[model samples]
Target chain A: MNVLIVLAHPERKSFNGGLVDVAVKQLEDAGHQVEVGDLYAEQFDPVEHAEQYPHSAVASDYFYPLNEQRAHYQQDTLPQDVQRELARLEWADLVIFQFPLWWHAQPAILKGWFDRVLVYGGRYTSRMRYDHGYFRGKRAMLSVTAGSPGIAFQPFGRAGDMVAWLWPMHASLYYVGFDVLPPQVSYGVQGGGIEYQKEDALRIHLNACKECWATRLAHWEREKPIPFAGWEDWNSEGVLCETSPWRWRLG
Target chain B: MNVLIVLAHPERKSFNGGLVDVAVKQLEDAGHQVEVGDLYAEQFDPVEHAEQYPHSAVASDYFYPLNEQRAHYQQDTLPQDVQRELARLEWADLVIFQFPLWWHAQPAILKGWFDRVLVYGGRYTSRMRYDHGYFRGKRAMLSVTAGSPGIAFQPFGRAGDMVAWLWPMHASLYYVGFDVLPPQVSYGVQGGGIEYQKEDALRIHLNACKECWATRLAHWEREKPIPFAGWEDWNSEGVLCETSPWRWRLG
Candidate 1:
């Protein structure tokens, strides 16, 4: 299998960069061909532009019919680097995004990469049937480091459970047709004392990547439906159930 | 109150653009000052280079302090557009973002603005106490238009609910100390064949904005905690009873 690693942080010396390095090596060690998208080093523009749309071809199956709503595709121009990254995405079987959690999310460069490269007719939708859109059967995983303790991502905790924090990305990837995998998270990136205490965290994360690579086919075969809280059920059917942590029984 | 509208969509004729028009008129009618960021026109850069970090700040703040992470305070390399945005943020009383929902979230340009402009010292933690960080008490809202209907955002349904979809943005804003009003979402923007229906929907949204503006001061006076889902309760503790649609039971 061919893999793509999209690294977003600018500081090569940063732990996130190290994460990318290890993941790439591990993927190669597992005999998978790996491609690197070092977004910042490549100077990728996260900003979107109009020209990226492939309007000429109305190819029915693999493409989206977005000619009617092309106006929404317009955005400020993206730098050349982003276009290159998109080209890379077109050539991979698995996409691994490695970045530090900035403001509880991906860095601007990474976000921008998604913005610019995943155009209306590209990643989100295409001439294909709406239900069978872009990124179908493609795989994506987020490899990240956070300053807070991983425990904070749990229910009844301060921040949120890491899974819930990543729910949107998970759902979006699923919605857009990707066979999403569980995230590889390294918490306490900032002063967690883990950096000194566990010099092998990177190796561990890489091993996780190898496990992911080894089990890619089986993982897809046993794909788990993403979980949802009660609020989602209530909001949909207007069901007011008491004693549920997620939904409220308004008077 | 002076407000800034950072228009991110490229098309001046898109529905998102029209929403911006409505937002400006409403804010002005309420006697608040408004300015347009017009990001697409100005071409703001969301990526921050290492050179953009403030010169005099200690390395601890640059690398470790969560509050100081996003600010690009260095006078020399700081772009003029970013300076202008920071100035507007400093000058305005409210900030309203208008954009077409791209892949279930804001466009990359807008997200990038938050990434580049909302710095650690400026939007998160600053020289002031942790509680009094920059953007403390600043009010913000997201007015978005989606191609899908409101029904699609259901719990047991295929996609995420509209409110839950905005979780990351809301959490980021709240974590950085901004007060986020409930997002005003326009569902089924692409739903065909009824101009009058679209107008009616727009009217209701405009009214919501008007109400928000009228009660902006009062709304600020209270703390509105965002509600979460209760699946964890069933998973961890146990399923409770039912109440109203929005209300949930503990234990």
Candidate 2:
């Protein structure tokens, strides 16, 4: 198996980084080929703009990202960084997004990866999404860290539902035809406070979390993807069919 | 009312840009003081990193964004751009986020705005969030454009549920104590391609969408905020209390 771990943290020594290290070692030990897309280390530009396409623009006057994406991709002129990321995606059987949950979502850099790297016409088209998505057969999962503890992320928790925060990302992965696994959330990640860093208990807790991640990766292939309503579940109007069981849960 | 419209689209001539114009005109005509945070025009650096906090560092070795945010905020040494954004929020009674929904969420630039501008310790804290957030009195709403039609965003739709796509963002606003209104989603936004840009029907449709947005802004204050589970509805574990009415729907 081939694995791609995309890390989106600024500090290489952060807990998120630690988790990536653990996953790489664990997956490699399991006899898998692993590649790391260290976004911050590579200085991956998160913002998509006109500058990304100096040549091969379908319309030079107006800068529409989706159009530019489609045009550049068709012309085989996508930016080097985007092309590299795509190539990584093509090489991997499983993709893991490692990042801190900043502001109830993935960090801007990773969010931008979805924005820039996933070219509309080339990667997914109107008819080629959902169950029929481009990267079918691949598996993807999110390994997230949060400043808030586990108790605070339950349904109606002050930290808000972790499931709810992750839904968009999870759904996005599913949209592109990957079997999306449930997220591995490492809660109570102490950030920037000296006491938490110095405390032995916190250190022990973090180590345990790392071990949990390594253990999860060891059995990733056996995991079931999170269930989502696919094309067959919907009617012509694009709403859930009245007879669909998913309607009861998600309606 | 003081209104701040933060736009995240790259092109000022695009349909998203047209919506911003409509909003400014509508709000200003209603005798409201309006300010536009044109992120593209301003060239807002969406990526938050060590460079953003050169002067103020609680711990320089490992960069924890929230810690740096809180420390810089406390010391009154926040980056000038961030301070300016904060001031805008402080001054506004109503905030409108205008953008094209890229990757089933806000564009990375706007996502970064949420990541960087909303200071953790200063704008919100562990205790001072949800119903008791720092921006409790202010109302914030999203004005979004999508390439897919409205029907395509329904539950089980090919484009996925708009509600699910917007939930993370809506929850984030509610987390910060903003009275989040239902988003103004202008769907079927034709992008790039000379045909759609030149089509008379597309022009007519865009005008109608613009009018709809303007009309909504005219009665903005009269509109009720979308209901959310509040602190009172939750138990000690932060889960919705079993006895709470919200438990039936959201549990």
Candidate 3:
């Protein structure tokens, strides 16, 4: 199996950094060819600009369905690093997004990655479907670290569960084609001795990534789709039904 | 009664443009001073950078609670236009965000505004507990336009309604202390070909803006808060709490 890790974080010594290392090791030990896109280390520019898609390039004709953003897909040159990351995404069987949660979502750089690399024709709507552009069938997972305690994330608590909080990321990824899996989250990341926490978090991340890969590999060979327990039955299109906090709370 | 309009759409002929014009006109008619920060027109860069806050100029030293983003925040110079817009936000009694809905949420530029302007020590997380951050007493309202038919956005439709879809936006804005009002969404924006529909939509927007201003004015004068049946109560926390089908449906 070929796996790609899209890692975002400024500090290589951070727990997120350890998680990245653990994920790489686990996939490699499992006999998969693993590649890492150390976004910050590579200084991957998250900002999508006109330069990202060069008109000189034959493939530049791809169009995103939305009208407001066509200029970005056409105008500027994509930074070299971002282009390279896109290539990795194109080659991967499994894509892993590793980062710390910021403002209850991905950091600007990671968000920028989506803003740019997931082009209209490539990842979402295209000129073929003037009204309905989408992403169809890939697999992805998130590995995140939150500073708050785990219990603080319930509906009755301060912030909701990290999984529930990440609806936008999941929906956006799944809406296009990625089979969105549940994420691995490390809570109480602000304390517990920085060095020890980093190691523990890394180990936990490794186990989560391995489990995710095993499940995907299982489904890859199976006739049935991998089932999601939390969501309702898949819709007619095979996408999971949309559910929200109230539903979760009521249930 | 000073109002600031932060318009995100780039196209002047767009219905979003018309809404902007109407909002400005209505605010002015109510005798409030209005400032328009037509983001795209002014070329406001939403990217945050080191230049945005010089050590000498920064009021709050903290970028993140843990202080990890200082370097990233200061990397690029805060673009002049965004700086000017932030200044305007500081000067206004109310801020109106006007944009077309993209993928069931804010356009990237508007999202970028939150990414940049709502700085750690500046717009958010003031050292003083109760008096935290700038833009405290200031109000905010989202003026959004949707492309689908209005009926397609109801609870029974594929995607839920627009109100529930806006929870995060309302939550984030409220957490930061904006006395948020329920957002104003013009559903069925694509149905503008129907004369009465367009007229009715425009009227709804016009009246809503007028009422919003009146509410703010009344609140400032220590009078009762403004009320509109269904509109204001749609989302009790000044955000629409209901769901829309467009959010869940693929089409």
Name the candidate that leads on lDDT. 2
Q: What is the lDDT of residue B115 in candidate 2?
A: 90
DockQ of every model listed?
0.24, 0.65, 0.12
lDDT of 1 by residue, B99-149 (tens): 777655677777778777766544554233223446766777776767765
TM-score of chain B of 3: 0.66
Residue B63 CA displacement from its true place in model 3, Å: 10
Ten residues in a row with the worst lDDT in model 3 chain A?
A126-135
TM-score of candidate 1 against the unseen true structure: 0.71
Write one digit per residue (lDDT tens) for candidate 2, span A1-251.
Answer: 99999999988888888899899999999999999999999999999999999974777788888888998898899999999999999999999999999878998999999999988999898778889999989999999998877988877566777887898898889888999989999998886332347788788888889889998989999999998878888777777888888878744
Which candidate would rank higher by lDDT, 1 or 2? 2
Error (Å) of candidate 2 at residue A25 is: 0.8
Q: A1-251, model 3: which lDDT tens digit per residue?
A: 78888887656666666677777776676687889887667666554433444453432332222422333345444446655766787788778898777656676667767765766544555232211323234467787877656665644334444544576676556555666666667765652224444477655654564455444444432233223222233244323346533323321
For each candidate, give its TM-score against the true structure. Answer: 0.71, 0.95, 0.66
Top candidate (TM-score): 2
Candidate achieving higher TM-score, 1 or 2: 2
**Least well predicted 10-residue stretch by lDDT in candidate 1 chain B:** B232-241
